[model samples]
Target: MNAAANAPRKLPGPVRAVGRRLPRMPASIAFATALNLTLRRKFPADVLDRLEGHTFAIVVEDAGVELLFRVRARRFVPVAQAAEPVLRFRAVAWDYATLAAREADPDTLFFNRRLLVEGDTEIALLVKNTLDTIDIPRTRGILRRVLRAAAPGGG
Candidate 1:
């Protein structure tokens, strides 16, 4: 393993600023599309039914971005806003990446206050457990490559 890969990487301030200024709909759309493409088939029908009609928000603190979406027709749909979301996850972008990469455990992050979850605890656990059950092909490698490319002196 390369030393660069092991080093911590943070999004540049300018990049974060750009992320903050960017529109949410496009981001939400991309997020939903990726979710549908990668994890939709793995999700149980019962879980989908339970998730239906519930809004969710992911707040990226450092990026200053909030993605609002809901499960409708068994698909994730981006929404501009929601009065109240059934679940809200707040975390920095790197933390989210690490979580997705499985380099950092969600429980550790939550306990350390790096990842914050709000709203329905049961649903949150369901989501977490469901994610843990399925394996996404090349997730860690892909995320590592992406992070490496994004890092200042990396790649």
Candidate 2:
């Protein structure tokens, strides 16, 4: 047996102890930080300023994946676990990836309900509209700049 399989596993709580793996906080945190920067440039300061104290949960239902992101004091904070999100959005991972990469139309999925949102409908709609209005090339340029800054000699 592999060394990991032979070890006594510790169960934290109600959740099952799926095999333990190295934590990926660095990449996730980086992604969230980059995403926040993109949001700031794409959206008005007042709109983003009002996002404080709201919890958003993005779920990839088919994959049984969940990511909890909370807006606290005008910053996006990733939570280990969250209960009763103020907003929940479910979508296929590919669709979201495509949208994020600027390869797909966010409106098509939203109109077809492939991208589902629950709770705080008005705010959600506003977010969707804002995302739709973003100029893909400009957004990509900003993101590329951010990536370059993150890496030494990356540009």
Q: Which candidate gets the maximum lDDT versus the true structure?
A: 1
> What is candidate 2's lDDT per residue for 1-155, written digit by digit as tens?
12111122222332322212324344346546866776655666666766777777876554445667777665677766667788888875545554665555666666667678889988887777777777768766664455445334556
Residue 141, candidate 1: Cα error in Å is: 2.8
Q: What lDDT would each prediction earn against the true structure? A: 0.83, 0.61
TM per candidate comes to: 0.86, 0.63
Candidate 2 Cα outliers beyond 4 Å, as residue runs: 1-30, 136-155
lDDT of 1 at 129: 96
Residue 92 local lDDT, model 1: 80
Whole-model lDDT, candidate 1? 0.83
Candidate 2: pairs in clash: none
The local distance difference test score of model 2 is: 0.61
Off by over 4 Å in 1: 1-9, 148-154
Task: Write down the RMSD of all candidates, one decimal each.
Answer: 3.1, 11.6
